[model samples]
Target: MTLRSRLPELDDATMSAEQRRVLDDILSGPRGNLDGPFLAWVHSPQLADHAQRLGAFCRYHTSLPLRLTELAILTTAAWWKSQAEWQIHAPIALKAGLSESVVEALREGRQPTFERSDEVIVHRLASVLYQHRRVDQATYDRAVEAFGEEAVVELVGVLGYYALVAMTLNVFEVRRGDEPLPFDEP
Candidate 1:
């Protein structure tokens, strides 16, 4: 299926004070530009500010290791079949030390083979969370044992934040330029 953005980029000069303030903040932030959900969230400047801050924390400051965090993000992206999310984060995940094979398997919607126990926990946590909307007691115990309570909580935050981003991208039909669809449409 051909995809087009539901919300076009807003013209800066025409924006309200609140919108411009949020836009400027996003521009100066670590993200350095309005990518992913920011353009869409800009329509609601309050939401834009809050979501962008939360996104920065989830993507950058979370207690979880970058590789594990990216693993969870990719798992969430694949669960949502979000092409933009997949394209944006796949390389990041790879650079953070996730194997190309693992990224490819997640892209293919199959369980990836993980060498590390932490990787297995992260992928399982994300997968079970997406599938069941919550984890079972055993799953919870395993995650906490593997990553501790703080990282486990951050892992959930990463999964949830990326899932929200996936939904935004899906709802807005956001794409990374003229790239062809990554997943076959149903």
Candidate 2:
């Protein structure tokens, strides 16, 4: 679908070349998609900042390995039913080391029963932070102690960003490719 038809909700047409390239890539749908609404929203100035900050935060913060970080991100997306996020990230998450079973549980909106102790800790820890905005003393102390203060701060920051992104995707009714994710795909 052309950008005009698929996303009539879009009120603007002036896309930066960089933005246009990204949009075209998303639309091409080779890997998966976040086809229309999300593309449209990110074209906006405000959401663009949020998107950029998230990328930087993910790379620089979080002592939870990229694998664990992706798991946290995927679980947040799934919990919020943010298809745009899940679309863009599921394959990336798999590549980063989230297993099929954990992805499925996340996609199905359940607390994933992760096999690894560290995965379980991150999942449970992230869940509490997102759901409550505060962690209990022990969990907080443990994570901060395990990851150190800076890393823990970064983890919370990264998770917070994704949580906000999920909210936007849901609010704007973003649609990726028509098909749901093959969470089990290798």
lDDT of 2 by residue, 85-145 (tens): 7876788889888898888888877767777777776787788877887888888877766
Model 1's alpha-carbon lDDT is 0.87
RMSD of each: 2.4, 5.7
Clashing pairs in 2: none
- All models: lDDT? 0.87, 0.66
Model 1, stretches more than 4 Å misplaced?
A: 1-4
TM-score result, candidate 1: 0.95
Error of 1 at 50 (Å): 0.3
Tell me how far the alpha carbon of residue 150 in candidate 1 is from the true structure, in angstroms, after superposition: 1.0
Q: On residues 1-186, what C-alpha lDDT tens digit does candidate 1 reach at each position?
A: 223479755786678899999999998999887778787888899999999999999999988889988999899889989888888889899999999999999999988899889999888888888888889999999999987999898888888899999999889888777886678765
lDDT of prediction 2: 0.66
